[model samples]
Target: MESRFAEPSVLILVSLASGPKHGYALIKDIEEVAGATLGPGTLYGALSRLEQRGLIEALPAEERRRPYRITAAGAEAVQAYLEHVRQVAAVGLRRLGAAHA
Candidate 1:
């Protein structure tokens, strides 16, 4: 199978790039940053995959919550992914602008 990060996984990494966060915190951050609300199952599922891929790491539990931080590889991944997104958006915007002109 092709090993590609899903949109939710990308968003999770994006959120963690700023700092570490627990499950609920990650969910809220994703909603705030991406404007998409992930259910508990979806959010935790992405977190699990991200951890398995070494994109993020879980810190020791603080109280009842365990937070995960992005690894260096995760930051690189985010940078590359955003660049791709930027290129696509720029081209699409240019096309739309010309169409309206």
Candidate 2:
């Protein structure tokens, strides 16, 4: 199946791939990587969707913070999305020339 990757989903998947993390940590990581803060409602909404899709699963809780890990399917989806983005960037870069001069 084609990846259901949107901006938030892709970002969340990438964040989880590094290792399992709690919701707050994931939000911080994504914001740090993106150099901007993502809204709490938007982040939790995407997390719910990702969990519902079976791309991520909740880990045993510690101190009321629920951690999550990327499922195998999530890895595949994120990889495919990244590859597609790379290809698009490559095409755009290749088209850059002295046209602005």
Candidate 3:
């Protein structure tokens, strides 16, 4: 099922792919990597969904902050999704270049 929160979900997954991170770390990482800012609600909501889907798992709470890591399944999913995006981007760029030429 597609989620209205797809973008944030993907961003979170991608960030976690790098390493486990708590909510605030995730926010900073995602912002640094993607130039997108996720508010607390959006970050937590996507984290819950990812956890429920078995794509991510939360580690033990450390100082009241829980870090999350991507599962093997999550890594696979993100790789596939990014490959598809790359293909689409390449085609779009090629078409734009052709039109300009």
Candidate 4:
């Protein structure tokens, strides 16, 4: 199945791939990798959708903020999505090579 991960959701998932993280940390990491900033509401909204889709789970509150971890199914979905991207990239590069030649 196509993951259809939106930009924010994909960034969140890629951030969570390393480990569980609270909202603030996710924002920082996503900025570092994605070069885009996510406001609190946007981040939490994506988090909620990921949770609802069973791709992620909110951990019990450590204090006021809750952390989140990726589910196994989520991991699989990310992998599949990445593989599809890789294939697309390879094809595009092949075309680029031909154009360059």
Candidate 5:
């Protein structure tokens, strides 16, 4: 949870917050939304960790691809993390504006 992989984990969770998606869909969604391209190694590594932590669960494979969905705990964790990010960004922006003024 607390590692260099945290960002990717959060991105994955946020992507799943909308609905379930397979590996390739998750990669595309993260790239499109966050402008960060996750290689297969990084994607699957984080996926493994998240699964171990109970933040996500893999659904039955559709042909060759396995879709994943965010659990309730995953939603709660992501919501809290994002809220903290929003607060930090708000403060930083306010300070920057004050300094400029």
Candidate 6:
């Protein structure tokens, strides 16, 4: 199966790129950032996959809350994805041709 990033995962990584955050913190931040709620299973699954892929790392455990940070690869991937989104938007806007509307 081809590995693909869910939108929530991408958003989570971008949020963490700024700094480390614990699980609930990440969930709250992402919900605010994306205006969507991520279920517990989905959130944990994404975090596990991201860590396994080396795109993120868990910090030392502090109680039940373990913080995570975005790896260098994660930052690069997020940047590239954002750039691609911008390019795609430009193409779409150009195709619309404001004069026609």
**Best-matching candidate per lDDT:** 5
- lDDT digits (tens) for residues 1-101 of candidate 3: 43233499899989998899999999999888887889999899999999999999999999999999999999999999999988998999999999999
- Going through the candidates in the order shown, the clash numbers are 0, 0, 0, 0, 0, 0
Colliding pairs, model 2: none
Model 6 clashing-pair count = 0
Expressed as tens digits, the lDDT of each residue in 14-45 for candidate 1 is: 89988999989988988787777888898889
lDDT per residue as tens, model 4, 1-101:
65333588878888999999999999999888777789999999999999999999999998898999999988888889889888998999999999999
Query: Which tens-of-lDDT digit does each residue in 1-101 have in candidate 2?
Result: 54433588888999999999998898899878765456889888988999999999989999999999999999998999899999997887777744544
Give lDDT per model, in order.
Answer: 0.88, 0.86, 0.92, 0.89, 0.93, 0.85
Cα lDDT tens digits, model 6, 16-71, are 97799988998898777766677888888999999999999999988988999999
Task: Provide the TM-score for each candidate, comma-separated.
Answer: 0.90, 0.87, 0.92, 0.87, 0.92, 0.85
Instruction: In candidate 5, list every pair of residues with a backbone clash.
Output: none
* Number of the candidate with higher TM-score, 3 or 6: 3
Which ten-residue region of model 5 has the weakest summed lDDT? Answer: 1-10
In candidate 4, which residue pairs get closer than 3 Å at backbone N, Cα or C atoms, i.e. clash?
A: none
**What lDDT is obtained when candidate 1 is compared to the true structure?**
0.88
Q: Arrange candidates by TM-score, highest first: which order?
A: 3, 5, 1, 4, 2, 6
Q: Any idea what lDDT model 6 has?
A: 0.85
Model 5 TM-score on a 0 to 1 scale: 0.92
Weakest ten-residue segment in model 4 by summed lDDT: 1-10
Look at candidate 6 and tell me the lDDT of residue 39.
81
Clash count, predicted structure 2: 0
Candidate 1 weakest ten by summed lDDT: 1-10
